[model samples]
Target: MIEIKGLHKYYGNHHVLKDINLDIGEPGIYAILGPNGSGKSTLLKSIIGLVNPRQGTISVNGISVAGTHAYRNEISYLPQIARFPDNLRVFELIRLIKEIRNEEADESELVNLFQVESDIRKRLRNLSGGTRQKVNMILGFLFDTPYLILDEPTISLDPVSLTKFRKIISEKKEQGKIIIYTTHIMNLVEELSDHIILLLEGRIIFKGGLKDIYGKTGSSSLENAISMLVDKNGK
Candidate 1:
């Protein structure tokens, strides 16, 4: 389980997150939604211990993630955009990630799943934007770790690739992994999430299942409910 208490982050005098408290358990998908510059990304970074919060406590399965090796090995994070070595080939990138994790992986399975084998020899600089996103997605899920955090994971994906990625995420969720996805796609949230956390400014305005959200907002669709909530809060 992942627990957060009194999480706050600031950049000099600018506060990004305020008194954030959340608890996420195993075998569930949590979709975090917020407007631009609402501290959504900052919260995700803090959860992964990539950015230190001014005041907070974040732990995964009883282990603190702030500068701890044990926590590092248990979580995988995929940023909104990824940069890879321009000279590295597709196969080389996967090979490198597998080697870094020190885990033997069936590279072909991942390659076929993402449909990137034809471009195995292509360098990162040569691949298109969607292909690079696919590569990034593969790296995040390759280790099969307990926790996965993906930020706008489907931004540049093509329709076919996006479908494959959705299936992969569903499989991971079924495996009892804790998946926290930060995305603006409400349709995806409705289809994939077990719960949704809605944020306004730096505070969480709402947190609950889809049915609860609909009931609260008097709307049946996820997008309508989110729009209602965000608009009401002046987001």
Candidate 2:
């Protein structure tokens, strides 16, 4: 379980996260939806111990994230933008990551699943944007950790790749993995997310299921419901 309480962060004089309190004790896809600069990435980073909060506490499986990297072993993070050495081949990057983690991962099946098998020998600079995103996705799931944190992973995926991505997500769900992602695509949110964490201006205005959102806003569609909630609380 990931528990967060009274979480606060600041960037100089600007407040980023404001008294954030949340608990993620279940296994499912949780979508963190918000406008630009709404502290979504900051919150995710805090959970992974990349960003420390000025106040409050974060605990994963009864272990405090403060001053500890031990909790990171159970987490797999895929940032919104992954920068790699331009000269490195796809397979070389994969091998490097596996070595860093010191864990045996059979990326062969995943490489084929993402249909990037042929591109493994090519350098990162040679791969297209979409293909690079596929490689990022492949690395994210290769660990099979209990927790997966992704930041806008589907930015450049084609329809076919998106379909395959959804398939893998469902498979992960079946394995009871806790998947948390941030995306602006409402269609993906409507289809994949089991829970929603809506933040606006560094505050969580809503956190519940899609059905709960529909009922709250009295709107039939997820997009409309979210718009209503944002409009209502944004002021």
Candidate 2, 163-219: lDDT as tens digits: 998998888889999999999999999999999999998999999999999999999
Error of 2 at 57 (Å): 0.8
Per-candidate alpha-carbon RMSD to the true structure: 1.4, 0.9
TM-score of 1: 0.95
C-alpha local distance difference test of each model: 0.87, 0.92
lDDT tens readout by residue for model 1, 164-218: 9889889988999889998887888989999899888889999999999999999
Per-candidate TM equals 0.95, 0.98
Clashing pairs in 1: none
Worst 10 residues of 1 by lDDT: 64-73
